[model samples]
Target: MSDQSRLGLINENPIQNGLDAFRALFTSICTSRNLPSTIDTLRQLGVEDLRNLALTLFTSLRNLPVSGSLHSTSGSATLRSVLLRLITAVASDSFDFDRIKPLLEIAISENTQDAQIWDFVSTAAAESTPPPRSIASSLQQTPCSQNTSSFVNSSEYRQNVDPVLKLELEHLYVGLPNFHKSFFGDIPELDMVSEAVFRKCTEGDSPLFKEGWSGWPAGAKESDVLTWIGGLISQLEAFADNRIPTSAARRKLLAQPKTPLEGSTGKRSMDIGFVDSDIIYKPDTTDSRYRWAHILVVGELKSNPKADIASAAWIDLARYAREVLAAQDTRRFVLGFTLCGSLMRVWEFDRLGGIASEQFDINKEEGGLQFVATILGFLRMNEEMLGFDPTIVTTSGQKYIKIERNGQTECLIIDEVIKRAPCIAGRATTCWKAHRNDDPHNPLVIKDSWQYVDRDEEGELLQEATEKGVTNVARYYHHETVRIRTDDDVRNNVRKGLDVTKATNFQPKRTLPSNVGGTVSRISRQGRSSSSGVKRPSSETDAALPPSKRSYSASPTKPNLDVLSNRIHRRVVLRDYGEAIYKASSRAALLDALEGCI
Candidate 1:
């Protein structure tokens, strides 16, 4: 029969079909007394047929009588061995063991008297075929001081970043800044612009006022909005040049619209990019595009006011922030804005999560001042205030991170970046292969990550382990928690003026039945902290019942608040350990390394 017809026949009555097939195989085995031939016959069946047969056998074994005659027979021993081998073959042929693991456990539990059969099956099914070579052996054979170019080109080094789930985005970016308070109070550059200059730039006949600032007209395009905002920033710069002394004047920045940013490997283009004027006009071959490294601020524009937490515009904004953070090694955080119609919201993205100011109408007098302040603030801010790490500096065209150990200073020349966190939030760990200025022959690993403030420092743990003579651990050199000029941790500096209480829970968009009433009944799982009670749809019993019928006695009294953990920046230098263990040259080598670790 054809594969399709055979699959249909099994689907019609899987249990009966499985029993008949097994009976035929058993009869053949009895007649010939040849297990190899019987096993070969079973292999001829399709992958789908084998899966159905396995499930059917598991079910039948679960229901089998405990006092059956087959349990006492010598032939049953042979049959059980064959069954174990068959399941192992299925798993090796690409069947997902995790999908059927629960079912296997259930079958084993139901037939507790047949312990040997279940134990053998479990062991055989879990065994995977070993590769020819192990990663540990390969690393041992290779020299640690080898050039990094070869390692960079290896397939093992090209690990892709995991895609962020939609649910995670909702949870990470829910905190809203107070609408009345300015988010840029720390920026002293805003003081340079007097009330007269601010009024002149935003009042009647200004770029913003002329572009429907009072209210955006229906069907207004994003391109027109970008032009208006760009013109306003230019006017601000023009005024700053004439009023401020030459020594006090800040470097000029240009607001370009619909420009494709270079440096990032991603092909997506930005709606608007605020970039340094000097680098933007440089005589380079990039054709007027700004590199993501040089971009001071990123902007997104939407024709409509649907740029909510769940909207595509917000997702794109998050993606752009990730690209910028990845491109600039020293960047601590990212500043971005989304203009939805005439409404504007400024956002800050860091290793923990994202925070945003409440939307404001830019056409009004008060909102116009807020808009200009944001633009001018970004323009006049120094390198440190723009989110670049001050300790990491470029001297004579080479990037180096200054390290002070035992009151003596040294520089770690950054040779190559090995890994960077793929997401915008969470512990953004970055690894770099570097060497000290005096010792260029021996390279070291410099690891940087945003660790949780409450957890024990990794550097301390490593130091303790080394002092106690722990084997197979990376040799620790130096470690420090990065601090700002004000002597506060980087995490504390970024969270100023943000109110976590005002944050709202992310409600996924789902269509409900017409008969369903009130909000969807969501219950928080037990053991979750009261401060952030994350809720989700309940168990199967609750799913079968209507929303109103579902019991919510376990729900918390206070509404769920989307709060993020506070993380402090930490950097550690370690002795170069070669490539990862997965690159082992032989199975024995890999096994040996794993055995040592255990």
Candidate 2:
């Protein structure tokens, strides 16, 4: 009797439960005695079903949460055998390497040090009598020092085996950067090194490029293209900033993988995260030390047009934008770009405005160098302005910049309009009881510095906004937006507009700057501090759900305002003392000048 029969899972009545079904499939295909029967069963399902089943098996391995480690997992032995058989089956039939190779890596990733798994994969690859005609032809034309036997024997040296992937694997195992580069000995500068490579690839002089005008080699594997694109971007990184990496070196810089809140314990692993043009911009802060990096720009590079990959790439970009918005309370301009040799497309994602994309030929005028330069400009801005150490407070507060002139100290607070009523179709500004330092007792109860963007009477967009009718403004600006305009602008405007002596004599500064750049400078203060009971939610939950469903608020319930007001009172006393000191300095200065005359 078959194992299935013994288990009471007959051919007609299979295991109904998902978990049991997978376990049954695993045991049946993995045992040596039942391997032929399993293959025959797959054959009965036809070639298409077998191909799909092969893919499903790979996905199952990826999604399965292994306990302890891959080796220690209960069914790991069965999984290993099943994977080996799948590789043998695919290679023997000359199945698409693009699909098969990624699946093989799933096994390699589980236990990278396992020599048996590597041996099986390499041996199966070698036993394949004939590769696809396109691959065979390309390989025949390509010049290599090693013969076919040697090529198949050395896994690392195989043309299809990506060195960068090996670098990623090595780093994943050991905390080393660019570990694979050690194998290459020494190479010249990329500009000089890439010239020969570029010529060979473009001219079809080397077998790496297909005949006529195909961008890459005939039957070029996905890894081959990704490795090439990664190399290309690595060269471009030198022109941009050394800290911003574009290759496997870039992946190393990412914060340790975080578990998603949606209950998927496995870390996020997307193609864009590895090889796509996306650049992750991390804030330079030691305050919150979870080395999370934000996706500033999403760029995808393709050698050939695969609609599925392209669509998936865009979805990844969109997902990245949402995650960034949830983490930081600033406006961000998430950019997207795709390059397929001469063809290029540009995209932008605006939280309120929606996303837009434009496509053009990079080889044509107004595209090539300009497009590259624009992206580099974005990278430069993200590194410098957006990626600064930010001050995070649990409660609503205003950052005060203290300025002094001739011993007369002036604490400049940007005055903002608090919209008592919400705007007709825009965001609302709320009253913020800013704490004196972190002390809620000394509150400088004030309005947010937000100015509405309005269209002119002509219905055209207005460069300058008027405060008369406008009430709403963006609640927060992303770090990227903060870089463009800063809180200093508010200070500069107030200082320049008023004659300090006259403004002091007539009245205290009533209104702060309506809008300030997001950057807040550090200032020192002394007082007992209290924080609001508000906490930002994790991005994982926000990422999984839609914009409408996700909650960004720290607290689900309303805050006690009466208690807030009393706590805010202490901070006000500190502000009063500061103002008194400024007045005393002015009087003392006047007395000193009189004494000098006498």
Which candidate gets the maximum lDDT versus the true structure?
Answer: 1
Candidate 1, 1-598: lDDT as tens digits = 3445433433443332323333433344335444443434454444443343453354233223321212212223322323323333342345454444443333323233343433434343345212122234323322111011111211110011111122224344453755223445655546547344566655665444544353344554866665566566677777655654454325444444444567654343567756665664544665656677777777777777765544345655766777788788788888888777767778777775666777777776776777777777777666766678887888887888988888999889998888775556656678889999999998889898876666578898888888898888988888998767543343356666465556554344322111212121222111121111111111100111111112111113212212434668888989755666878998999888889788
Each candidate: what lDDT? 0.53, 0.29
**Per-candidate TM-score against the hidden true structure:** 0.60, 0.30
Measured with C-alpha atoms, the lDDT of residue 286 in candidate 2 is 35
- Model 1: lowest-lDDT 10 consecutive positions: 537-546
lDDT for model 1, please.
Answer: 0.53
RMSD of 2: 26.8
Candidates' RMSD to native: 16.8, 26.8
